[model samples]
Target: MAHTIREKNKLLARVKRIKGQLDAVERALEAEAECEKVMHLLVSARAAMTGLTAEVVEDHVRTHLVDTELFPDALREDGVEELLAVIRTYMK
Candidate 1:
Protein backbone atom coordinates (compact mmCIF):
# COMPACT_ATOMS: atom_id res chain seq x y z
CA MET A 1 0.00 0.00 0.00
CA ALA A 2 1.04 3.61 -0.50
CA HIS A 3 1.10 3.82 3.29
CA THR A 4 4.10 1.50 3.39
CA ILE A 5 5.90 3.63 0.86
CA ARG A 6 5.33 6.72 2.97
CA GLU A 7 6.16 5.00 6.26
CA LYS A 8 8.91 2.66 5.10
CA ASN A 9 11.61 4.73 6.70
CA LYS A 10 9.77 5.08 9.96
CA LEU A 11 9.01 1.37 10.12
CA LEU A 12 12.56 0.50 9.26
CA ALA A 13 13.78 2.66 12.10
CA ARG A 14 11.63 0.77 14.54
CA VAL A 15 12.91 -2.51 13.23
CA LYS A 16 16.45 -1.30 13.59
CA ARG A 17 15.82 -0.30 17.16
CA ILE A 18 14.38 -3.71 17.93
CA LYS A 19 17.35 -5.38 16.31
CA GLY A 20 19.67 -3.29 18.44
CA GLN A 21 17.82 -4.29 21.55
CA LEU A 22 18.02 -7.92 20.61
CA ASP A 23 21.71 -7.59 20.03
CA ALA A 24 22.13 -6.10 23.46
CA VAL A 25 20.28 -9.01 24.97
CA GLU A 26 22.51 -11.41 23.11
CA ARG A 27 25.67 -9.72 24.30
CA ALA A 28 24.43 -9.70 27.87
CA LEU A 29 23.84 -13.40 27.75
CA GLU A 30 27.17 -14.09 26.13
CA ALA A 31 28.88 -12.03 28.80
CA GLU A 32 27.08 -13.97 31.50
CA ALA A 33 25.52 -10.93 33.05
CA GLU A 34 23.44 -11.19 36.23
CA CYS A 35 19.97 -12.66 35.89
CA GLU A 36 18.31 -9.41 36.88
CA LYS A 37 20.20 -7.38 34.30
CA VAL A 38 19.46 -9.85 31.53
CA MET A 39 15.83 -9.98 32.52
CA HIS A 40 15.58 -6.22 32.34
CA LEU A 41 17.04 -6.19 28.85
CA LEU A 42 14.65 -8.92 27.75
CA VAL A 43 11.70 -7.07 29.20
CA SER A 44 12.71 -3.86 27.51
CA ALA A 45 12.99 -5.64 24.16
CA ARG A 46 9.62 -7.26 24.64
CA ALA A 47 7.98 -3.95 25.43
CA ALA A 48 9.41 -2.37 22.30
CA MET A 49 8.09 -5.25 20.21
CA THR A 50 4.70 -5.02 21.87
CA GLY A 51 4.52 -1.32 21.14
CA LEU A 52 5.29 -1.93 17.49
CA THR A 53 2.66 -4.65 17.26
CA ALA A 54 0.04 -2.37 18.78
CA GLU A 55 0.76 0.38 16.28
CA VAL A 56 0.43 -1.99 13.33
CA VAL A 57 -2.76 -3.58 14.65
CA GLU A 58 -4.39 -0.22 15.31
CA ASP A 59 -3.44 0.95 11.84
CA HIS A 60 -4.92 -2.19 10.32
CA VAL A 61 -8.20 -1.66 12.13
CA ARG A 62 -8.33 1.97 11.05
CA THR A 63 -7.54 0.98 7.48
CA HIS A 64 -10.30 -1.60 7.17
CA LEU A 65 -12.97 -0.19 9.45
CA VAL A 66 -14.65 3.21 9.78
CA ASP A 67 -17.05 4.74 12.30
CA THR A 68 -19.92 6.51 10.65
CA GLU A 69 -20.51 8.53 13.78
CA LEU A 70 -17.03 9.91 13.46
CA PHE A 71 -17.37 10.65 9.77
CA PRO A 72 -21.04 11.08 9.06
CA ASP A 73 -20.30 12.87 5.81
CA ALA A 74 -18.00 10.09 4.78
CA LEU A 75 -20.65 7.40 5.16
CA ARG A 76 -23.54 9.46 3.77
CA GLU A 77 -21.79 11.59 1.20
CA ASP A 78 -18.90 11.64 -1.29
CA GLY A 79 -16.26 10.64 1.22
CA VAL A 80 -14.63 7.63 -0.38
CA GLU A 81 -11.60 9.82 -0.83
CA GLU A 82 -11.37 10.32 2.87
CA LEU A 83 -11.53 6.62 3.54
CA LEU A 84 -9.07 5.92 0.77
CA ALA A 85 -6.65 8.39 2.29
CA VAL A 86 -6.85 6.53 5.57
CA ILE A 87 -6.37 3.17 3.88
CA ARG A 88 -3.39 4.50 1.99
CA THR A 89 -1.85 5.60 5.27
CA TYR A 90 -2.68 2.45 7.24
CA MET A 91 -2.13 -0.18 4.56
CA LYS A 92 1.56 0.30 4.95
Candidate 2:
Protein backbone atom coordinates (compact mmCIF):
# COMPACT_ATOMS: atom_id res chain seq x y z
CA MET A 1 0.00 0.00 0.00
CA ALA A 2 1.08 3.57 -0.61
CA HIS A 3 0.86 4.31 3.04
CA THR A 4 3.31 1.49 3.70
CA ILE A 5 5.67 2.93 1.12
CA ARG A 6 5.45 6.28 2.81
CA GLU A 7 6.37 4.64 6.10
CA LYS A 8 8.71 2.09 4.60
CA ASN A 9 11.73 2.86 6.73
CA LYS A 10 9.74 2.80 9.95
CA LEU A 11 8.11 -0.47 9.02
CA LEU A 12 11.42 -2.01 8.02
CA ALA A 13 12.92 -1.04 11.35
CA ARG A 14 10.09 -2.73 13.19
CA VAL A 15 10.52 -5.84 11.05
CA LYS A 16 14.24 -5.88 11.77
CA ARG A 17 13.61 -5.64 15.49
CA ILE A 18 11.09 -8.43 15.28
CA LYS A 19 13.57 -10.55 13.37
CA GLY A 20 16.08 -9.97 16.14
CA GLN A 21 13.54 -11.07 18.69
CA LEU A 22 12.91 -14.26 16.75
CA ASP A 23 16.63 -14.85 16.46
CA ALA A 24 16.94 -14.52 20.21
CA VAL A 25 14.25 -17.11 20.66
CA GLU A 26 16.06 -19.46 18.30
CA ARG A 27 19.33 -18.97 20.12
CA ALA A 28 17.71 -19.62 23.46
CA LEU A 29 16.29 -22.88 22.17
CA GLU A 30 19.61 -23.97 20.66
CA ALA A 31 21.36 -23.25 23.95
CA GLU A 32 18.83 -25.40 25.82
CA ALA A 33 17.91 -22.51 28.03
CA GLU A 34 15.52 -22.83 30.93
CA CYS A 35 11.88 -23.29 29.99
CA GLU A 36 10.84 -20.02 31.52
CA LYS A 37 13.57 -18.11 29.72
CA VAL A 38 12.62 -19.65 26.40
CA MET A 39 8.98 -18.94 27.06
CA HIS A 40 9.76 -15.32 27.78
CA LEU A 41 11.69 -14.99 24.56
CA LEU A 42 8.83 -16.52 22.61
CA VAL A 43 6.36 -14.17 24.23
CA SER A 44 8.52 -11.17 23.45
CA ALA A 45 8.72 -12.15 19.80
CA ARG A 46 4.97 -12.69 19.67
CA ALA A 47 4.34 -9.29 21.23
CA ALA A 48 6.60 -7.63 18.68
CA MET A 49 4.69 -9.27 15.86
CA THR A 50 1.42 -8.17 17.43
CA GLY A 51 2.62 -4.59 17.73
CA LEU A 52 3.69 -4.51 14.11
CA THR A 53 0.38 -5.97 13.04
CA ALA A 54 -1.51 -3.33 14.99
CA GLU A 55 0.52 -0.47 13.51
CA VAL A 56 -0.03 -1.66 9.96
CA VAL A 57 -3.72 -2.26 10.55
CA GLU A 58 -4.19 1.18 12.00
CA ASP A 59 -2.40 2.72 9.02
CA HIS A 60 -4.55 0.80 6.59
CA VAL A 61 -7.72 1.96 8.28
CA ARG A 62 -6.61 5.59 8.33
CA THR A 63 -5.14 5.75 4.85
CA HIS A 64 -7.52 3.52 2.96
CA LEU A 65 -10.79 3.67 4.80
CA VAL A 66 -10.93 6.86 6.82
CA ASP A 67 -8.84 9.42 4.93
CA THR A 68 -9.29 8.41 1.32
CA GLU A 69 -12.08 9.88 -0.77
CA LEU A 70 -12.10 7.01 -3.21
CA PHE A 71 -14.54 4.84 -1.35
CA PRO A 72 -18.20 5.66 -0.76
CA ASP A 73 -19.37 6.21 2.80
CA ALA A 74 -21.14 2.86 2.96
CA LEU A 75 -18.12 1.06 1.52
CA ARG A 76 -15.80 2.69 4.01
CA GLU A 77 -18.07 1.72 6.85
CA ASP A 78 -18.19 -1.84 5.62
CA GLY A 79 -14.44 -1.98 5.31
CA VAL A 80 -14.03 -0.70 8.85
CA GLU A 81 -16.44 -3.31 10.15
CA GLU A 82 -14.56 -6.03 8.32
CA LEU A 83 -11.29 -4.86 9.78
CA LEU A 84 -12.78 -4.76 13.26
CA ALA A 85 -14.07 -8.30 12.91
CA VAL A 86 -10.66 -9.53 11.84
CA ILE A 87 -8.99 -7.70 14.73
CA ARG A 88 -11.45 -9.15 17.24
CA THR A 89 -10.82 -12.66 15.99
CA TYR A 90 -7.09 -12.09 16.00
CA MET A 91 -7.06 -10.68 19.51
CA LYS A 92 -8.94 -13.71 20.77
Candidate 3:
Protein backbone atom coordinates (compact mmCIF):
# COMPACT_ATOMS: atom_id res chain seq x y z
CA MET A 1 0.00 0.00 0.00
CA ALA A 2 1.11 3.56 -0.66
CA HIS A 3 0.76 4.31 3.04
CA THR A 4 3.44 1.75 3.78
CA ILE A 5 6.09 3.49 1.71
CA ARG A 6 7.06 5.71 4.60
CA GLU A 7 7.54 2.72 6.88
CA LYS A 8 9.04 0.35 4.33
CA ASN A 9 12.53 0.38 5.76
CA LYS A 10 11.32 -0.24 9.29
CA LEU A 11 9.06 -3.04 8.19
CA LEU A 12 11.81 -4.66 6.15
CA ALA A 13 14.15 -4.53 9.10
CA ARG A 14 11.60 -6.34 11.24
CA VAL A 15 11.12 -8.95 8.54
CA LYS A 16 14.86 -9.45 8.33
CA ARG A 17 15.12 -9.99 12.06
CA ILE A 18 12.26 -12.46 11.95
CA LYS A 19 14.02 -14.30 9.15
CA GLY A 20 17.14 -14.55 11.26
CA GLN A 21 15.14 -15.90 14.18
CA LEU A 22 13.57 -18.53 11.92
CA ASP A 23 16.99 -19.41 10.55
CA ALA A 24 18.22 -19.94 14.09
CA VAL A 25 15.30 -22.25 14.77
CA GLU A 26 16.05 -24.20 11.62
CA ARG A 27 19.69 -24.55 12.55
CA ALA A 28 18.77 -25.69 16.02
CA LEU A 29 16.49 -28.32 14.59
CA GLU A 30 19.18 -29.58 12.22
CA ALA A 31 21.65 -29.80 15.07
CA GLU A 32 19.29 -31.87 17.23
CA ALA A 33 19.36 -29.19 19.87
CA GLU A 34 17.72 -29.64 23.26
CA CYS A 35 13.95 -29.40 23.35
CA GLU A 36 14.04 -26.42 25.69
CA LYS A 37 16.39 -24.47 23.41
CA VAL A 38 14.37 -25.24 20.35
CA MET A 39 11.17 -24.25 22.09
CA HIS A 40 12.67 -20.91 23.08
CA LEU A 41 13.73 -20.21 19.50
CA LEU A 42 10.32 -21.15 18.19
CA VAL A 43 8.60 -18.94 20.71
CA SER A 44 10.84 -16.01 19.83
CA ALA A 45 10.11 -16.41 16.15
CA ARG A 46 6.37 -16.64 16.81
CA ALA A 47 6.42 -13.50 18.92
CA ALA A 48 8.26 -11.63 16.18
CA MET A 49 5.65 -12.69 13.67
CA THR A 50 2.86 -11.60 15.98
CA GLY A 51 4.50 -8.24 16.48
CA LEU A 52 4.85 -7.77 12.75
CA THR A 53 1.22 -8.62 12.22
CA ALA A 54 0.16 -6.14 14.87
CA GLU A 55 2.25 -3.38 13.29
CA VAL A 56 0.76 -3.94 9.86
CA VAL A 57 -2.76 -4.16 11.18
CA GLU A 58 -2.37 -0.99 13.19
CA ASP A 59 -0.98 0.82 10.16
CA HIS A 60 -3.85 -0.34 8.03
CA VAL A 61 -6.42 0.76 10.57
CA ARG A 62 -4.89 4.17 10.95
CA THR A 63 -4.28 4.75 7.28
CA HIS A 64 -7.44 3.33 5.76
CA LEU A 65 -10.22 2.83 8.27
CA VAL A 66 -9.69 5.56 10.84
CA ASP A 67 -9.44 8.58 8.60
CA THR A 68 -12.77 10.31 8.78
CA GLU A 69 -11.73 12.75 6.09
CA LEU A 70 -11.30 9.97 3.58
CA PHE A 71 -13.92 7.53 4.78
CA PRO A 72 -17.47 8.15 6.02
CA ASP A 73 -18.35 7.22 9.59
CA ALA A 74 -20.50 4.21 8.66
CA LEU A 75 -17.89 2.89 6.27
CA ARG A 76 -15.15 3.32 8.83
CA GLU A 77 -17.20 1.47 11.42
CA ASP A 78 -17.84 -1.39 9.04
CA GLY A 79 -14.21 -1.54 8.00
CA VAL A 80 -13.08 -1.59 11.62
CA GLU A 81 -15.52 -4.33 12.47
CA GLU A 82 -14.31 -6.40 9.55
CA LEU A 83 -10.72 -5.89 10.60
CA LEU A 84 -11.51 -6.87 14.15
CA ALA A 85 -13.24 -10.01 12.95
CA VAL A 86 -10.18 -10.93 10.93
CA ILE A 87 -7.92 -10.25 13.86
CA ARG A 88 -10.05 -12.45 16.07
CA THR A 89 -9.79 -15.30 13.61
CA TYR A 90 -6.09 -14.73 13.25
CA MET A 91 -5.52 -14.75 17.00
CA LYS A 92 -7.30 -18.03 17.29
Candidate models: Cα lDDT each: 0.71, 0.78, 0.79
* Tens digits of per-residue lDDT for model 3, 19-79: 9998998999999999899999989889888878876776677666555566545455666
Tens digits of per-residue lDDT, candidate 1, 10-92, equal 98899899999999999999999998998999888888887776566655554445564576445423365565456557544
Q: What does candidate 1 score on TM?
A: 0.66
For all candidates, the clash counts are: 1, 0, 0
Q: What is the C-alpha RMSD of each candidate to the true structure, in Å?
A: 8.5, 3.8, 4.1
Task: Enumerate residue pairs that collide in model 1.
Answer: 4-92
Stretches > 4 Å off in candidate 2: 66-92
**Most TM-score-accurate candidate:** 2
Candidate with top lDDT is: 3
lDDT by residue (1-92, candidate 2, tens digit) is 45689989998999999889889988988999998998998888888888788777866766665435565453566667787778857753
True lDDT of residue 17, candidate 3: 98
TM-score-wise, the better of 1 and 3 is: 3
A best-first ranking of the candidates according to their TM-score comes to 2, 3, 1
Model 1 stretches astray by more than 4 angstroms: 65-92
Which ranges in model 3 have alpha carbons more than 4 Å from their true place? 1-3, 66-92
